[model samples]
Target: MLKILKYLKKSSISVVAIVLLLMVQALCDISLPDYTSKIVNIGIQQGGIENAVPEVIKEDDLKKLMIFIDANKQSQVKDYYHLIKYKDTESDSYKKNIDKYPALKNENLYVLKDIDKDELKDLNELLSKSEMALLTIENNKNQDNKIKESILKSFPIELSVKMKDKSLIEIMEYLPKEKTNAIKKEIMKKIEKMPDSIIEQSAIIYVNKEYKSIGIDMDRLQNKSILKSGTQMIAIAILSMFVTIIVTFLAAKVAAKLGKTLRTDVYEKVMSFSNEEMKKYSTASLITRSTNDIQQIQVMMVMILRFIFYAPMMAVMGIFKVVNTNVSMTWIIGVAVLFIVFLLSILFTFVMPKFKLVQKLVDRLNLVSREIITGIMPIRAFSNQEYEEKRFEEANRNLTKVNIFVNRIMSFMMPSMILVMNLIGILIVYKGTYSIDSGTMQVGDMMAFIQYTMQIIMSFLVIAMMSVMIPRASVSASRICEIIETNPTIKDSLDIKTFNPDKKGVVEFKNVSFKYPDAEEEVLSDISFIANPGETTAFIGSTGSGKSTLVNLIPRFFDATKGQILVDGTDIRDVKQFELREKIGYVPQKGILFTGTIASNLRYGNRNATDDEIKEAADIAQASEFINSKPEGVEFKIAQGGTNVSGGQKQRLSIARAIAKNPEIYIFDDSFSALDLKTDAALRKELKRKTSESTVLIVAQRISTILHAEQIIVLDEGKIIGKGTHEELLKTCEIYKQIALSQLSKEELGNE
Candidate 1:
């Protein structure tokens, strides 16, 4: 998978954009839980009173709070509050305050002034502690002896007894300033030791009472806070969703573009491969690499773009939020993550090996299916349809069994993850209930912790899913890279040579020995031959005598193993393959045609060939009769491989395509075997006239097909046993005479 990412260089800008968008998406996702916590903790549980520092407090209430506040901090707190008198209705600020806080109409109120977040936070901390201390002392006045003892431990013995009778504020009023300051300092120390959450809750309770006294609508305040937080949550959600859509679109585009680029590179690489390379990789395997294997990489690319970066960011951010929300519950997330890793580790052990096998099985199934489809006629003729069915079934069943096994293992992952997630949720809530009851954790904070835990777990889940896909895609990437990285066995020389204009239409093979790759013995050895312009050179041999192999050398499908083959006075290896093949028109042992109109197939040899040229070539190949029979004529559609046409007609069309090329050399490699004698005779006779100025090479099985050739080479094994015209070879070459005798009578040979 990493190997394939180099193709994404073209899409680097889009990938960067996707990364940025994924970060935004992660931020939004991680923030939502924090908002939910605020809504629950502040908006509902605290009646929308966010902190210990009240926005507006009655002047008398403010004085009560000041009694508990330290002298040094009291001046700073008073500086942030403005005294609004009920009689100051003429003032614009008093008018606004009276309308907002109606309690201003009854008494003077102290409204908090604007301050920076740091200052506000300091004020909130100080006031929250002071409010809690004051409330504790007042509550202790009527409590039982045990409760009073715990509350009064920090106070002096005389003050502790006085705290049980006189209210805290009255006792503070009577005491000297030095003594009262000392008592306040002691109470502050005790309050400082208390949990910050408990202090904030206690402060908000006092703030709620202050608001009620000031004629503030408590329900409206709570509703407004909830609505504002809910709106922000919805907006973040929509924004995250929008970012997700764009990320998905960009990721898909990058993956699809990469797929297209890979397919093209693989196809072009395969096209450049020599026959030796073709033999190294089977046709079915190449097909899979081009399509299914590439598809696997494409899917993995999207996942990598979507989750590879995003998952880790989410996991880290979620962990940070979890830690900040409450540290105690973080253990639940750690254990859940460990278990998830263990689960995935077990899955990988069982499933990774199978992924590689699945791709091979797909190749096997495709190979079997292609063979059965292409050979259906042969199978039916041999009455072996059932045997072929079993072969296909075996391939299919093997593939299916592996797929099911892999799927079963993967199927176990999601439910198990969900189970772990649910169990973790239960444990968090169960553990959180104790913290909440103990006044250490708030409801909102616990809820947010649960959400963050789930988010963190889900991030691991995404990584786990990608872990499975990455191994499979890595296998696919290796296969694709094999094709893309392979250097063709046959390549043009760096110092390329061009053909000599004076030596056009000349082909020479000097001591040419050929063998298939990895073969021990040469198929053709020490062969030497030359075919000049305006001449016909024919090869006749038994089935394995290297006749077709000899002609195939002219086009350089496979380079000669032990000798040099040259065309137009230049070594074929020194010239580009395209330039080498362009001068020759070759029709293989079997006729092959692509899916297109008949005219298009004919023009395939020379795309610039005119309609008249097409018809003329067809006429020369003796195919005009059948072509004119169809209503579409030259426009008649040809199925792939010309399967829609008869064998003879397909061969004639193949011959016509070669004729349409009108090249300097023509190779007819048993291309006439499918035709009847009459058509073959007529085509050869016309071909002689049409190619009178060009060189022609023929590999034939029938003696009648090459009896009139200018030169005939007869091969007994890989060696050329006879070379001469028919009449000359019949007299001098015993092997030629016997082959001629087998195909024709003595009178026929004498006549030729």
Candidate 2:
């Protein structure tokens, strides 16, 4: 997975944008809870607008507020100046004040909150200190509550409190009676400037008038808060949606590009592989690696972009919000997250090995399927359809059984996650209810806690989901890497030279030998031969005599294990494979053809071949008669592998494709085996004249095919048994004589 992540560097800007958007979205989500708590705690719990302020503000408290207003020149308080002057609180002044300054009433109401916070704590302390000073001045003799009240009300509350206990007692005793009375009279004069109370029938009457004059409009406040919060939440949701779309699009684009690049890389690498490498990884496994394995990595790339980045962020932010709201309940999120991790760990450990095995099984299944599709006719002809079906079913069932086991384990993931979430929700509510009753939490706060907990759980759920796929994707990445990292055993040699010899179409093998990779013995050994320009060289031998293997070395399909093969005097290994193969037109024994028109298959050899050149080549290979007989002629369509055509026709077209290239050398590896004896004889007659200027090498089982060749090399067990024309071989070579006698009578040998 990490290997694939390197591809994401191209989209770094999108990644950063997605991250920023996620953060904004998360913060907005966290903000809604505070609004919920506020609406519940302030709007509904506190009664409507009428009861938003305290009823009984002391008379002295009002005067002190007025004095502070005067000193500060506060413009916000200027509208309430009438209250300072409205001493007759019992008259129409209360009603008139509400009618004159309705806006000021709401301001004054909420300002009480600030006033209560700023002045209330110190007010109680001031009252307590004043009582102590009064008692000390009276020498602990003031049992009369009224007299105590008079002394307390005589001076400024702050000033009286400031006088030390020793000073107050000394003032009462050391001062003369007249001086003491004069001091008391002066203090009383200062107190009289702001009257103790207005002309109300009682203190309760005074308190009622004040509350009616100034208090909050709670309905207005709640509506405004709800509107603001709702708008914010909607905006956040829209932004989050846009971010998700962008992230998804970018992730898909990256995955597709990664898959395309990986496929291209694998294909180009495979194209460079020698037969040794091709054998190392079978055709079916390579197909799986290129297609199925790449798909796995592509899917994982999307999940990494969309979930891997998002889950951790959400989990961390959710945990932060949870701890911020109620630290005690944080353990609930932790326990849930831990449980999810444990569950995922158990499943991943068991299923990951299976995921790797599944790919191999898929390869096996593909190999069987391909074999059945390619060889269906043979299976039917041999009456082994049921056997083939059973073989395929066995492979299919093995893959199916493993898939079911893995899926059965994975199916529990979603339900188990939901179960954990529900159980945690119940646990949170159970604990939160007690906290709410104790006044430490509120209903809205509990609801927000639940949301945060869900977010945390969802984060872990994302991780759990990813855990299931990451192992599989990781296995796929490694498989793809295995193909990509493989170095072809056969590659172009350094200091490569061009092969533009004067004697074109010359091929030579000097002491050549080859062994299959990991084989105990060589398939071909110490073979030496040369096919000169404008001459035919053919090999005839029994089965497993390295007939096809020796010819394969000419094109470097598999490099010679010992010694060297040369084309036009240049070592084939030292020339680039593409350059070397370009001069040689090879037709495999099976006569493979791609899906296209006859022209397209022929053009595969030379895209620039003219109509006349195509017709001439087909004529030389005895393919023009059948090709012209068709309704479309040269434009006739051919099915893949030429399955729609007869075996003889397919082989003729294959020869014609090679002939159209007009290459310097032609290799026919049993290419004429499919044709009838007459068609074969006629085709060879035309081929000899057409390729008279090229080096022609043929591997054939029939004595008739190579009897006319200028040089026929007979091989047996990787060693050359004979090297001469047919008549000379029949006279000198035992193995060649045996092969000739089996295919032709003594009279036919005499005619040759």
Candidate 3:
């Protein structure tokens, strides 16, 4: 996977943008739970009161609260609230506040002035503790003697007994200033020990009663708080969704563009391979690398862009939110994460090895399938269909077995993760119930903690899924890289040399020896020959006599190993492969055609060829008979590989394609084996007349194919044993004489 990183440089800008958008999405997702906490804690439970600091209080209630407040803090608290007397109700300021606080018509009110968040927070803390102390003393005044004893212990015993039946405010009026201050100090000490949340809850109850007294609508306040938070949640969700869509779109585009580029480069690389390189990689493997392997990487790229980057961001942010929400339940998330990591580690150990095998199995399956399809006729002719079926089934079953095993292992992931999540949720709620009952945590905070914990676990799940995909995609990336990175065994020299224009149509091999890349011995050894313009040079030998290999070297299909093969006095290797092949027309042993019309296949030789030139070439190769007989003539559609046509017709068309090229040299590599004696003789006669100015090289098994050639070379094993025209070879070369006698009668030889 890392090997393909350079290819991703073109998409760097989009990738960076995706990263930024993923951060935004993570932030939005992390924020939603906080709003839920606010709605539950403040909106529903506190009657929409966010803090313990009352916005408005009756003047008498404010004085009652001030009794418990510290002397230093009382002045600051009083400074934040202004008195509005009933007499002032007629003024503009009082009139403006009257509708909000309708009880202003009967009593003087103390309304809070504008304050910053820091000051408001300080005031809330100060007032929350004071209000809790007042509420505690008042509620305890009516309780049993034991509870009242704890509160009355601050006063004298006789004084406390008389004050037991009085209200807390009345008791305070009976005590001296020093005694009252001492009692208030003791009450504040007890309230300070209580949790901040409990203190705030108690204070909010008192504030709610004050709001009721001031004619403030509590229902409207609660509804507005809920609605505002809900709207913000919805907006953030939509924005996160929008960012997610853009990220997915950009990821897919980058992956698809990379896939296209890889396919094209793989194809061009394969096309440039010499025969040696072709033998290094099988056709089926190359197909899998270009198509299936590349597809795997493309899919993985999208996952990488979406999950790889986003999952970590979410995980980190979620952890931060979890820590900030409540530290008590964080252990549940920690245990859950450790268990998941262990599960993923075990899975990785077992599954990583199989990913490599799966790609190889796919190659095997494709190879068997392609061989069976291409050789179906031969298999049917030999009555071996059952054997081939068994071969195909073996490959298919192996692939299926590996895939099922891998899938079965992967299928365990989601349910196991869900089980962990469920168990973790149970543990958090069980643990959180105590905190809530003890007044250390609220319902809203616990709920938010659960969500944040889940988000953290979900991030790990995304990473686990990608971990499984990465190994397979990594294998695929390596396979694809093999094709793109390979250097062909045959390449043009860095200091390229052009052909000698004055010596056109001349091919020479001086002590040229050749061997396959993997072979031990040379297929052609110490071979020397020259075929000049306006002459035909032909090679004939028994099977495996280096006939085809000898002719193949002239086109530089495989460079000569021991000696030089030159064209027009210029070494073939020194010139570019394209320029070398352009001057020679080559016809392989098998007649191959693409899926197109006859005109198109013929035009492939020379795209600029005119209709008259095409007709003349077809007529010379004896292909015009079958071509003109068709309803569409030259426009007749040719099936792939020309399978619709007979062997003889395909061969004739192949020859016609080469002839249409009108090159300096023509190579017929046993290309006429399917033609009959009559057509062969006629085609040869026409070829001799038309190609009289071009050198021709032919490889043949039958002696009649090369009988009329100007020069004939007979190869035995890897050596040339004879060279001459037909009559001279029969008189001088025993192998040539024996080959001729076996194919033709003495009377025919004499007549020739």
Q: Estimate each model's TM-score.
A: 0.96, 0.81, 0.94
- Top model by TM-score, which number? 1
Assess candidate 3 and give its lDDT: 0.90
Candidate 2 per-residue lDDT, tens place, 62-133, comes to 433332122344443332223422344454644555554353433332123235543544433332222222
Candidate 3 residue-wise lDDT at 59: 90
lDDT of each: 0.90, 0.76, 0.90
Q: What is the lDDT for 167 in model 3?
A: 68
How badly does each model clash, as a count of residue pairs? 0, 0, 0
Clashes of 2: 0
| After superposition, candidate 1 runs with Cα above 4 Å error | 143-167
Ranking by TM-score: 1, 3, 2
How much is 390 displaced in model 2, in angstroms? 2.0
Model 1, span 280-359: residue lDDT tens: 99999999999999999998999999999999999999999988888887889889999999999999999999999999
